[model samples]
Target: MSVKSAAAKLFAKKIYKKTQGWSSNPIASQKNVLNSLIKEAKKTQFGIDHHFDQIKTFEDFAVQVPIRDYEDLKPYVEKVVKGEENILWKGKPLYFAKTSGTTSGAKYIPLTKESMPYHIEAARNAILHYIHETGNADFVDGKMIFLQGSPILEEKHGIKFGRLSGIVAHFVPKYLQKNRMPSWETNCIEDWETKIDAIVEETFEENMTVISGIPSWVQMYFERLQQKGEKTVGEIFKNFNLFIYGGVNYEPYRAKFENLIGRKVDSIELFPASEGFFAYQDSQKEKGMLLLLNAGIFYEFVKSDDFFSDKPRRYTIGEVELGVNYVLIISTNAGLWGYNIGDTVQFTSLKPYRIIVSGRIKHYISAFGEHVIGKEVECALQEAMEGTNARVNEFTVAPQISPLSGLPYHEWFIEFENEPDDQAIFKEALDNAMRKQNMYYDDLIVGNILQKVVITKVVKNGFQDYMKSIGKLGGQNKIPRLSNDRNIVEVLNIK
Candidate 1:
């Protein structure tokens, strides 16, 4: 190995070991560490004007940098997309991550040198968790299947460049480069229509031990695998052990993947965006994840109520109350300060900084006019799945408006493990769970909001097929579960 590669590996190992047991929970340790880090950041020229240096207390940081959504940074993103220097960071950014959000009119977040390390390190931690989970850390660690986006960016008026994924691929360390699946790294897709085809062809070629990317894309790959009559991982790559997913909930697509692989592949959850990788699945234990606070950002959470209420109070890692749902906010070295990423998560524990992604503050269904968050849907699904051979791989609830009452009704499309003989019981259980968990749903069912729940059993790989149709097959990709707009629902053929 070259000296740089050797040193990189050594450094990675050392940091992992040093921080591994520092505290059973990294969450409790964040306050002191953050306060100290802020103190040190103040010493830097960048943090000086940013007020990181001036803020001593948590309240000070909160007051100094108010909570900001993506809309707040549109002008900054425009500048970054135009390749302007010093819009949010010191140097020219490597690339812009283009992401679509509800309130933000298209975001192109800048990824700078100072902020890249956080993403790299957090992602590395996610891998470590996978290694621990599969207990196959020593397995043929030859190549990892990233299943990520290629760099083929579209600029204004035919002025195009490689996409951010392509740019990041080039910048990844060389040693790690060899570890990536050739299919994921290669920019072969010429357009959106061919992207899924290119990805499906690539995935079948390797003995991918560690698979990473969005669940929706992964599901599409597996759907293609099955369509080709490939049944088991051993049939393609015998040593495959892990499935790393993030960007969106995998609940809808999880079962099909497990059953098709015919092996319990270790699963890892990652919290990443165009901005940076924030937290990752610490599969070393159960429930909650180890937040990568030390990465190129300082993290904060505001209670879900506070995030939506007229008065919102932000809480530091140390200040987070256990079991309460909060919206994630981060101030990164990449120049995104006090940015609310719109994810709703709750602390399962405080010591290690483990959290559960409850739902998106914006990504909920209440078209029936009854507010239903992701957590409520998850609970209802879990309850509904009880006493049946059926297991839901992935699911989404769309509200269908009634012409007569002009009220919204919920239509559930679920991908099941095994198609149940009796659908009515399952539907009843789901309804009962919904009414129990959400008073709004109860009110709707009893009165005027939404009259009844409509349940549909799709082909085991229905969601996967939808993703393939969309041509978004890999990398930081996920199908939105609850979109306010009907375009996605109609396209997916969800009733």
Candidate 2:
């Protein structure tokens, strides 16, 4: 067995022992967890003065800090930038998590030591859960590759800081440290190009056993491997066993990786963002992800339909019902009290509190005046692909608007496992399916009010390569499945 695997096993045992009897009932046990965190935050240098005064109950938090989007916290973040104390985070803010922004240029999210551990703990829990569910931990012995963001330090106008990704990478277990693969850091908010290149050069041809990151970035890495004359992913990393993906959906890109590698790799999904790691798919059955409810935060769920109501009722972890779609609101040590991260999720089960990412509240395609979410798009794509010999390897849906035409219409960029003869038929079926499910789509199609829906076939890995070219290829990287505007669509203009 590889030394890394042995160490991981040892750590796993320790983790199990530490969390032993810590509640098999996920919901019933969260109150105790939240209480402990609230106490800890009060003790932290940053959280002392701001020890949650109004957050008594989970519902109390919802009422205290009304469900807020990122914009709601912008003013506070600006205060942090001005060196204000007790605004965004307490203590000297360690650094900002430079994140991808849709409307803004790029977000510099401040992080504090009080809340940094939440991200680390969430990751640790994810690792533990993966081992517990798969039991592959017993047999598998290989190096793990983290297809992560840059680990470089940045100095913006004399303020010195490194990326939060860099900080996390720095603290990984010393033994398995050799397993991290090198990635380019050209535009990395940090200018550690030389050091980053050195790290990658040292690990070339090493025994990389598991790979994890954004599906798109991982695809880019595989393409880079191909350019280096490596015929298959397995050939490049002969010891690989696990592939973990996060930030965006992996369903569309799954087949391409399997085909290129010529073997099936165990896959896991992580629901992580610049804010924190929230969900993890550790189970082998590919069920819903388990959440990190107690990692320096208190979580509340509000029914998505009830969001704009005068009195929106929120549910605690224990009170949440199964099969209901809810918008997640969080109160974290980072001074975000009942902050809404914009993603919508549905509870699949109650035992371990398993939930599926339904879609983003902001991410929708209403081009034809039909509001369609991520889940709806996923359903439409699945229905269209059913019974078809050709499997959809990857896809992006957007609304194309032309000033001359004066109306916008649906457009899809589809990548198939194998080219199909009847491309028109596939597009027709998908459009028909979407219209049947969404009344807005049905009206547009029946009245011929908007431009006809169109699908364009791209070479395999086309979009993946496009994202990589822009240096966005990892867990925090975003690939929108639905867009009603042309601004985001233009990002895909690359060949």
Candidate 3:
């Protein structure tokens, strides 16, 4: 190994050793984080208003602060946007991470000085943990291509606003800065298609070892790279080993990604949001990410089934159980109190508190009472594609709700890179897989309550074109895999 590679290995080893204690006692670790946040924010207006001074325990904290979504917390966020101090955090946020909203237009989430480090640290630890687990640190010696948004942040009322990925790019460590690909000018292009083309031109010959981004966008880059070089990604970037991704489930795209790369690389899943960096995959041997118990956020879980019910039961980190879907509720240093980020996750392990993101609470199909989540849909799709030559490029599902149609059924719009020879058999395989996974879906089909799923083969780049038209084609923007309404389906013009 070269001198730089040796140094990287040492750095990774050191980070692994230092951060191992963070998840030692998951319950106690989270409680300590919560206590610190509560004590620090107790002097703020929000803290005072929420009786933070009286919150001596988790139970006290939960009782004093009610669960709230983005809408519920908008008043305080608006104040922050207007340069109000101590409205949410102790002072105005360092920056605002603007999330592209599907139903709620747009949301500006705070990124406080206290909370910013957690985002940076979580990403750093994710790599460290990967190196520790796999004993692979050569990636650090080569370039890393982070498929990020424009780093040129927009200033509004003295607060910067941009995609979280772009904001985080500003904080890439000095050491890694030398090894990071795609110049700042390329990243600042704003348009994803234009930006990706620039990135392809700039990094096509770089010694790329790591690539990080939402799967969809990175996949686009890979496609472009292959087109230009007429070589698989593995042939182009021979040293590429680690792919860190989040924002969407990677399973359904796993086969497609492997085929594009021409080999399997170490994959790490992360649960990073505009709200906070929550978890990171710590072990290759494990299925889920190790929850960051000592991070700036204090987590609460409400059973997904009970989330919409009156007086939903909330569970603290210690109270969470393995295998149950829970809507994640968070109280963070960024001034969010009992905030439901809308994502649902299930604990895969309680020992060190590891979780797999199940789905988004808002992104589900339950039109006929057959509630199907993104995870279930993804799994079903993966199963359907098994023992077949089919490779999915992109897909989305929406409920076909029309009283005139006799019976409601789910409609799937999919773009295939390699089409299945027998389309009817492919559709049947997906239907059978769905029935096997969800009893409600099975009953709906068997009892003739709902018609069989309708599959629509979308034109190439159909979803991409839809997103581009909306001016939200990149950086954290994702096509919701499942929706109760046909908003996306209509936009994509999928019949």
**Runs in model 2 lying further than 4 Å from the true structure:** 2-4, 17-20, 23-29, 33-55, 101-105, 137-142, 155-164, 183-204, 364-495
lDDT of 1 at 164: 45
Write candidate 2's Cα lDDT for 1-495 as tens digits: 566556767777676555444436565457765665555455433344344554576554444456666676676666666665655544546667765333433456666677777677766666776776555563244456665545666755333355455657755755445444553343232322333344344444767777776664466556556556458877777767788777666665678789777789887777876677777775778578877654666788889889878878878877788888899887666666567877789988676677888866667874332556565677778887887776877777886644345444687777778655677787777888776566546645553445556777767677787779778876687677777565545655422
Cα RMSD of predicted structure 1: 14.3
Report the lDDT of model 3 for residue 246.
Answer: 85
Q: Give lDDT tens digits, candidate 3, residues 1-495.
A: 777767767877887776667676777788888999998988888898899889998889878899998889988888999998988889789999976432344678999989999899899889887877777887777889888767888998899988788899899889888888888888778656677789999989999999998775677789899999999999999999889998766765688789999999989998888899999998999889988878888999999999989889989888888899999999898999999988899999977789998867777886554557677788889999999999998899998755465666889999888899898999999999888767557756764546788899888898899989999998999988899678888878543
TM-score of each: 0.66, 0.67, 0.76
| RMSD, every candidate, angstroms | 14.3, 14.0, 13.6
What's the distance in Å from true for residue 299, model 1? Answer: 1.5
lDDT for predicted candidate 1 compared with the true structure:
0.65
The CA lDDT of each predicted structure is 0.65, 0.64, 0.84
Candidate 1, 358-427: lDDT as tens digits: 8667777744334466667777788877788877777777766533554346777777777667888878
Alpha carbon lDDT of residue 389, candidate 3?
Answer: 97
Query: Lowest-scoring 10 consecutive residues by lDDT in candidate 2?
Result: 187-196
